[model samples]
Target: MARALNDGPGRECPPALPFVLAVGVTGHRKDALPADSLLTLHDRLATVLKALTEQAAAVQEANQSFFSDAPPRLLFVSPLADGADQIAAEIALRLGFELHAVLPFDRGRYRADMSDEDGRVRFDALLSRATCVLELSGESDHHLESYVMAGRATVAHCDLLIAVWDGLPPRGRGGTGEVVRLAHDRATPTIHVPVAASDELKIRWSAFDPAVVTHAEDQANVRTFGEEELGAVLTAVLSPPPDEREREFIHMFQGECRRKLRTRIEYPLLLAATGVARLRRHHWRPEIGAVRTHEEWQTYCDACHKVAAVTTPIASLQSWYEWADTLASDYAQSYRSGHVFNFVLAAFAVLLALTTLVLPDAKKILAVAEFAAILAILLNTQIGVRRQWHRRWLDYRQLAERLRPMRSLKLLGLAAPDPPGTAANPTFGRWVDWYAAVVWRGMGCPSGAIDGDRLKAMASTIAEHELAPQVAYNKSVANQAERLDHRLEIVGLTLFTTALLGCVVLLLGFAFAPHWVKANSNWFTLLSAGLPAIGTAIFGIRVQGDYVGSAVRSEQTARVLEQIADRLTRNSSNLSRAGDLVEEAARAMHADLDEWRLLNQQHDLSVG
Candidate 1:
């Protein structure tokens, strides 16, 4: 069928391929300068150049790897507005790329508007340094002129606009509409950079629950322009013969499960079918996509997801494969650590439980350590489970996107290993790793180690990820976990305090507590007090279930992060094209409390 269509007349695919001919970055407050207050302009200027060089190299690498071997030429365009522009220009200059500084027509007046003495000096330096300056409109307002000039450069000169917009759409300034309007007006492509200004890590993983992305997939008219191309793809995927390796492996697993065509990619093939069964068995696909109008694609995605859920088993096999291969040392370390921690907790718990039965000493410290260790195991388990789920979705999402012709899923990992002296996950890693290294190992660190009182103020709102519906919807498992965690924290704190107080009360009763009354006047008084204490103990014990705990859902977070990162990865090929869907979803999720009501203005006006 596909062969027939490929040979069809008037419907031939183009061989020219997609390309980004130029790069233009523009933003107010020199958005590319990394949001620092301590740095001088000179210090920042140096950093920005380095940043552009590295980023451009990354861009070039992606282009070379994916689209073509011929390295794309860099066309640096900015107003040269003192910081990012100056750096971009200088970097381009040093890299021997063409620098087209699209300046405002009234560059003199724009220069005049600078009230800051340092800024004026820096601007003067930037202007002098630029390769060439093209003019914007002749306007009185420098702010207005710079923006207009930027708009013009995007339309008149640049092929692609790299908007270093700090991931925010300000009032009439950095909005997508501004870019779209200009792009439409001039018919140029634009790419917004830095993903989002507020995103510290510059990437995040989203739970690619097959169901969620399925709905998105259904809605996508990847065949915006028809079925001939899509049908060709569908036939290729659905009718392809299974690989020989898959066939041999399938017979090994179960002779009858083998099909003539299925033997080729046996591992992934059976794994997908088996994985689907497992995910369903666990009821992990929490949210279902709406029943679709397109039944064929829907069934296809479902089958694909089921087949891919085997990704967990596949990843486990891969993990084992790595262990068997060169990563043997790393795997050995992981296994050893796992066993050591398990042994330590099991021993500690046994000792603590024994002491609880017989000891009259402050042997309770043993229990604290045991409980903390248990919590760590549980948290790590949750994180693992979440990651497993993400791996499943990621494998399929890649296949889905590739098949859909949405965009290619290229990445940094395939080409290069991490450099020395950097943590794997940097932004959240510092805090997460610090806790793992210091606090999470055992309970009760030094007095200096904890700021218990400081945590009290923020206790009610512990970075409410649940309130963000996208996170909640996409990562229901993780959201429940985060909620359970927060609840457990309260429970853990209460129980620890209660246990301490109980020991103290027992101690005081044995000695000084007799002061209030000739306390042993009646056994009834002691019984009455003991009854309430027992009740409190029971309540605390019940609350501890919250700490017995929810899974970490880290995989869900990682999957979601991959989706976010994938957006950036796609842009390296088509530098001017904007993927606003991700930006909107992210902003909608990340928006704090204040933006909601202001953002929902029409509702109240309509209701009132």
Candidate 2:
């Protein structure tokens, strides 16, 4: 049975920690800011932070089941630059938010870039106050690129961005304007706090595509940043959207229970028939309530500890991954089994109907049996559809897979990229991306420097824990799918061939001896008609499963992962190269997932 990580031999599991709301800041430096307007900017920043904190508390209280007993936490992400970043960070600190500083360079070099002794002193004071500081890895000569990267990282990590801008274009590569644009591009909600009195404060609510706007000032759906608008944005970020379908999904995810006996029986039968049992003999029997145990979590924790000390964020993410992965496995089994059972039930129903010809005196009984069989198929399909088995499996698996690679990504201070075009509008009824963003915010950025030794360790961990295992899994899947497809084809063809032989025999018997032909007509009819129906059912299942297509895709993916693994081995010490390879491997896996989802989406369980 599955037990919680903290559960003892007989103890119940504890609830998970509450969600975090991360807000980031980017704006003009001290030199660019008007000296007289500093107090106003400070007050505006304070208002925004205070409003978000109150809104977040209300959201968590309203949805107690979605959160833990503890209240939701606020995280403030900033680069702690001389002007706007520091102002926002100070306000956030006063509001009881945890401060996470993302610096463009190490302390000494960064301090050297400050204009005056006062600025440097303030930087040191705030840096000392921060809970975590992530100094990005880069040389002093490439400072501009590092700053741009820092801006991107801030946007990537935060749930919301606060830009203390002056309603103008960027003055340089990593200016406040550039950061705001990055937030717009990534669809991160932003509250634009004007540095001047004339410009109106606005919020880019992330509801429309910025690409459609011809002018910067004319960005689509820019709303005035007021109490009501900020409340709406905060509500949207703190919880799943108000769509009914999305609400249903969240409920199901929270419930996390399954009871599908038909699935348990049907899934194994399909596996056995398709030759998948040859790969794993355990498929011959049903699972005996195998669940993720506490021991399994301990093992994962041990692995993570080997890479680095077990931090709160790492442990939290690992726990979530385990929960999602297990739920995904259960749903996948149930969904796949529903379809397989439909195919078999369809075949059996026809065979039951054909039994009337073989036993004419018991036609009524056969009719009832056939009706029951057909009913079973319909009921199975209806249950699968109403419960959203297929969608839950895909979405939960996507969530789990995305979380799987974060250990490495977090070490290098990288965030997973959102799906293409999701910036405008994410997929309906799918909140996995949103959930992931929230969790990423909770984790914040890694709190240290990225050095050559750390890069080597990350490379080794990825190769051992991620790429190598995935390569093996893909290879296994390729072989299983290829074998199953080939075996099913052979079995289907043999059934049809036997039916032809049966027809030939019936014709010969009719010509040689009419009485004999009439006496055994029922058996011959079954051989000719029943066998063909069974063969057609098998063909339908094979086509719907797309075994051949799966084999090809898995093989190609395995090859790509193997190549990435090789590169990791060659360039283990290069952090930039390792980051790229890790991303490449993740992309390959994501592409494969997209292809698999597309292939099976149209193959919903049906009587046909």
Candidate 3:
């Protein structure tokens, strides 16, 4: 039976969130209220200024990373008036990030009204860099806002919007509020750094999807498919047919599947050699031949989903897709949060180390203040790092290790581990391969698109929720282990050297002191003091190192997990369409399963 996408419920992909950056221009506003006290204005200005500086720096970093370092790339920015805008422009110039303006009024008029000398310069500098600076010159009403809104709406389609807010209520000058509101309307993650919350910054980065972005926009993007609609679609593909000729067509289709299996495994590869989104450019494949009508296919799809619901508590393939989508959303948030947290903590650790150094007898004080700062930062960091490792990387690793064709692992005498909690999906590698294969066939992936790299990226989506706690636990062990090992290495070296230095000091004390003093010198006393300190140092180093070794083992385990995930991802995508086609062909030909298995097994595909 032949099936077309028209014969089945169409899988949906989320739309892109536009990257809009709203920069708050700093400096004095001309119209300060008569009621406003100088102190209050100064306080507000101080808070706002601090926030702008931070937001600008974060924006610059994000600009560099998003466009150059990762996917869902960013190119343009939406900035408003304020110091934040200046910072944003500075970043754009350095990184080559594009800028566009949604002006509230005529630029010349706005400039004429502004009193501050630097303010005009700041505004002019920002204007010079914009790709397109659109004016909000409508009637003084909501629709007038549409000029900018329309501009934003156009940008929102590209993916990502950055809104720099005062973190206060929307009473401030300029349209930072509107920028944020519009971005939310588009289901975009707003990188909000409140003007007052200068010391801390929170980044909400989602790859795509409304939940991560907002309520209204999400509603606009995701379409809910009912059973009737699905049934009508699936009715086209089935075994029973209208005529013998149609039955003959089905036979031909089945024959095609057979030939496809015996020969090369094609499909599942998304070749950028053609280019990204090239599938949209390619001609559609011939429809699946089957006796089932579109309605019947729909019925089967819905029924299968309904039955799936009962069989699996979460129930239904549709639900699973939804779950996967949700997982993708949450995954992005968790990943970003974990990373940001680590980066901040690491920074804190460095700062703390530096601060402790300035204190009198800091080493003695390090045991007190340094320990608390170090412990807190390290603990939090370890927890966050481990969480990230488990959520995606570890699962991918384990799957890869399990899924790799046996001979490759055997060559190194390496066998995949049945990770402690994955009994339910013993054949994770196979399952992932199956999922990828289905995606491949539907997508018309030609080749290389479904390689090792693709598989690893795909498996990142498969990180289970249960894995979270375990990942954290694993990371904690890893942190302690790493800390211990590092401490050991540094301390061991430090102590041995210190001991040797102490003997030298003992000799030097005599030489440095006068001969009379040396004769009456408390040489024995100095030796006693120095020797004890050296012993203490050595003892502490050894003790710390020994305890940390266990943590190191955990770290080692984490690395192994990462490797396994990479392999699983690679194997899964490679096997996707081709793997299914091969098995189907073998089944139709009635070839020996054992021989087929052996033939597949005997050839080490890793070399290729």
Candidate 4:
């Protein structure tokens, strides 16, 4: 069976999986709406939805590798308010889009806030039709802030925002204009449907511009969103970039392959060294299992399901993470083994060549063996470089780590955290970001009211499952790395010290016993040459692995996670506080991963 790196016992490798496109709505309520404008607004909104649906199909067809057989799911996110919200929900339902309602208050309070009986009835009808409802908790006195939170939540959850506005500034705290601004700030695509009688109903894309004035004239001046423009936007958001290397990597990762023999051979040495070190230590017990198993993942999903109102595709996210994690482990083993074997081969080649001096009768055989060793080194390095084992290991590990936190982030309505400086570093794998974002969009938000009780439950679950396990894993990694570094350092030092003693012995023998020195000179030469060559090789492996650096980074990360876990335990009931802790934990993990990538990227396989 193929082994996973740092995987917990009983972990199973799974096979590979598409995404959901969420469209949100923000517009004026019925009381403020012009009667004549409603019909045109409805028509334009429907047209945009239809265009999106059609364009999604085209993009899926073009990029079938990225998606499954099922077409992309279209989710309509709305608060189901009296006017524009209800209108968009109705149109979305008619177009077969799944409605996910995000309300500022619970259903009862939201219904009672409607001014008229007819509006209340419409609201209930739409609410009943919604596939899932996310009710936000808010006190009566702070209803305006709640509305702002709801609007921001809707914008955060959706891929596209449809603002049915009158091309004017927001009159209230959380109205159509405010939602549009939130969407703009988030860089979510928005389609503006003019509801003002004076402004024509020409649908256009509202590109986010930080410098643009928040006025009707400036908003209306943007270019019209025609069919081609909409298609371009959909394609850009939905499809991964046309990078052939990434595509090839996906194929290789998903294909069935056995573990490399070199990696298998190296594992026992690593295991023995770490196992001895762990046996020597006594104070720390693992907080959680070292490896994450399928059963553990199921437990996590069960916790999420218990609190969630609607069914979330969390298992799908797990499968993606598992697939990436498995591949990353495989590549890590291969890449690390490649360097180890190269170092060993280089030292062996030196030893073999030096043996010719000791046994001159076998010079031809030693020369042939040394030549083969050199050839093997060239072959190994070439294969590693050509196959990109190091590159794939870094990329897949980065992707897996990003996906790992989504289990908690999705529940909190937070997107996957990006590596720092991703925008500035053009070499960063943008396709990884696109892939993670697609998974996040596909999972969407769990529909339900997050009361204080639910907030506390989710926080506890995160602490127990997410943060605790990571803390344990990081500590274990740090210990293991420190132990390996220490062992290698000792071994390298012993070899060099013995070589130095051999030199002193050879010097003393030449002065005191010339005949004895002449008889045993080959032994001294082997000691002086072979020991140092092997010692240098060992040193090279140590540097290439960067075990000491890894230990320090992992230890620091463990401390940060412990701090976050403590804060989460204390502020479990506060939703904002819990969300902040989760983000902080995620940032810490991302920082660690970034450091690991930087440390390993420059240590690619080389003959030296």
Candidate 5:
């Protein structure tokens, strides 16, 4: 009859895919690359970009089902400086790739670096065509730090870097060589195009060196990669790594749920304290539209903010899972503790009654104590019902489980619409809709088709990472529920057997030896009443726990998930079929939630 302290299942969210591949550009000024060579670099860069577009199209074709409403795009980002950046941007634009400019400073001052009138005109035209321009604010254009900031921003967002250089050290800060070194240190992949050696006199000054250091001969030399090598590098950079795996949702659930639950429990206590303080002050009218003191206004604002915090959708999947899990676990613990105390009190009361009947003296005192015990039991039950701890526990648990599958589905790029064809607006306050919307927005439609090799890798990931763990967890839950169910029935029946035996003994003593019966009549009476009373309390505890019903429901859910796991693990299952199986599992999970909700509603308990 002790309250169950079993831990419930935790939830997890699926990891998201990278939405775009950003390519960054860094190289020398226009003077370093002759006009003829600059045109050659432009044509070669354009050809490479066109081939990349085709590769994206091929990926899109293979993984048609994985995409969201808006397909992912290939983004080419640059500082749009006078030489290499401008050439790359012009080529990328022609190939239908997005061009994002990360400027060192505002255009007016940055334009001063162009020097030539023709270069300034081209810079303005390219800036107009850019999809996005990120200007470094609060920095003077006159400073070299501004240019460095732009270079750092470009590297930060891009997956690959293209450098056009003459293998020379930087003449000043924010030069091509310095940017290339940064890219190398960060392990960003780069394709360097060599420039022709210049015969002009060079002014070399190194702050680190004692005297001005000059190169005996220019290091600039040609060693260009073939078309095949460039294509292979581009493919490697753009494609998602086959081995990269997303983190599981349950791990996050376990961590986050505790914090969320604590906040929930504190809210009511805080609100109650606030209410009583105002009540103590006679005729304190804290009307919404009325003028108030600073303290009153602050309290009002704080209350509103707390309400918003609870009701709003938690943006991160990990955060959302934690809150729901914490709410469920805390409420469940409270519900269990109340039932345990009530069960113990009820049984003790019955024992006290039997003692009062058989005792030679202080019978009235013993009876009063027994009555007090019963009153305590009833009071505890009333308090539990008024607080609605059991109901809230069930509701929060339902929400948590429903969200778990969504994390996996979204991560695998196989999530289906709830009740297919229904548009789920995630902003909806209802947890289900809100969670669905958040996941959908988080994992937007990917336009690139996944090749067969990538598709196979995804299938293996689903089987090992998601389906395998879920299968094990559900099976364990089912087994635990069944064991609890069996124990409850056994205990309930044993109590009834004890009561029946006590009745048999009482009847036999009264029927066969009349003289002996009179001498021990009090004992017989005690046995007849107290044993049955204890048995009745045992039955009541069993009814409250609903162990049998829970066991059956858990077993059904476990079986459903197990079947889905089988489908997912089959060697012949293609990516499309795996997607279908995942979708089926999601449906099954939701169905389980609906069933639990109905059961909790039907068995709603009240003090009356």
Candidate 6:
């Protein structure tokens, strides 16, 4: 199938996450500067921006090695007030970097802040040219709060802060120093472009000290930077080495599993998805149209549109796979730990029995070992409960199954389930659903309607590659489960039979060999008590494993999936019928998974 589609007026498939350098500005107003200093400051601003742009380009080139699909973009974010903000925006535009404007209030209310008539026209022009304009909504009565938040917001969004100041304390609310202070708190690197009210054009640069203990200390201990350090600083702040934490997050989502063509490229295709944590959007392809028109595009020139794009459908699928694999691995490890402890405890009980009946040479003091073993078992149970290993295993497995069919539906470009409520749904399930929603929304739908040919292709693909294999897998699982159940039954029955035989022996000894039974009362008593305990413990272990119940559920799931597979295969030739069949099968699989979870829920960690 032809994957490439023509790009036009509609929404473009967003590009991968681009290397964006968001620079925020805070500085002296025109009123604060001397009349003679204005032009020099403007020229100085232009020089710094030009240098930064070049530095950013180099950083982008280096980043391209890892994030191949992401292009580099330089964006200056500011609220275009009379002096430094307007100057910086104009300089950034002149340098071909994008501008993003943030306002504390509406443009009409904000226009009043500009005393310069010429500055007002310039502000409007700059605002119009901005790639994105973020207008914060709040009560206008508290002007200071609005101002402070806007500064905070700008600082929050920016990678670097550009302070065009003389290192003076802020004169009022949300002043240059205040914003700079906020930036310092966040450890966001700031470039201090010292501008005085003098006509003498001595341009010097400095940066905030991240290690400074206090704002006062930071202000006092500013590190002066020469031209030689400029490139290094930009590289450090903009394209620093990827962190270990980020690598761990990525690794968590990557797993070896059977995947569709889309899922095979899940990691790299992550470029096509964007979002902020739970909130996300995805771009299905890179060649689609821009999200905004040219006019609207101007408002977002500085925005990295791809950042909010949805996760790749394949990637979402991969996440579920990874989660499932992790759950299985965790469950197996937990089960093994529990089983070992139980076995050791059982051995201790048997040893105590032997001490009373078979080993007359040993003193009762040896029974202390049995008591210690019993204590160990109690401690193990407590530890397991505290860790919630069993609960986590069940939860993650349920989560995995919930997301299982989403990948297939996403691949086929079908509608996905709605995002689950965090309050109502299980924590893992809610997150899974939220992630799927983000991918679904970001992907939107295919541009044109699904025609017969597309339907036929989908059906053929699912039938040959999906349905046939799924049916076989389910059948195999059912067979394994049945065998396991049979094995469990045999083990349980043998324990009971041994206990029964011991009872018969004890009865016969009591009836026929009364004198012998009297001489060996302790031995007979030990056998009578220990046999039932051992038998009961064995039965408890079998029940705890839920081997019987699990086999039953697996058998049911396998049968339903097999039936659905048959329907899909039979209707593969008919496009309409095949589409419905595929959807039905996917839903049926999901339903079966939910049913299996419910069945598991019925069986807790029972030793009774």
Best by TM-score: 4
Candidate 6 C-alpha lDDT tens digits along 38-125:
8788877877787778777877676553222435666777878788888888988887767767676667777877787898999889
> Tens digits of per-residue lDDT for model 2 on 320-405?
77667766777777877787778777888888887888898999988898889888888888998887888888888888777767
Instruction: Between candidates 3 and 5, name the one with more favorable TM-score.
Output: 5
TM-score for candidate 5, please give it: 0.47
TM-score of every model versus the real structure: 0.26, 0.86, 0.25, 0.86, 0.47, 0.45
* Model 3 per-residue lDDT tens digits across residues 518-562: 564344444444444444533433342243544554555445444
Report residue 456 deviation for candidate 2 (angstroms). 3.6
- Candidate 6, overall lDDT? 0.55
Taking all chains together, the TM-score of candidate 4 against the true structure is 0.86
List clashing residue pairs in candidate 4. 7-291, 8-291
Candidate 3 accuracy as lDDT: 0.35
> How well is each residue in 455-512 modelled by candidate 1, as lDDT tens digits?
2211111112111322443455455445544543454456456656755665677686
Poorly placed runs, candidate 6 (over 4 Å): 1-313, 336-340, 343-347, 350-354, 360-365, 418-432, 439-454, 573-576, 602-608
Ranking by TM-score: 4, 2, 5, 6, 1, 3
List candidate 3 segments past 4 Å from native: 1-76, 113-115, 136-158, 168-174, 197-199, 204-608
lDDT of 5 by residue, 501-572 (tens): 877776787788778878887777776676666666656655666656766776777788777777676642
Question: lDDT (0-100) at residue 465 of candidate 5?
Answer: 51
lDDT of 5: 0.54
Give the worst 10-residue stretch by lDDT in candidate 3. 258-267
Taken over the whole model, the C-alpha lDDT of each candidate is 0.34, 0.74, 0.35, 0.74, 0.54, 0.55
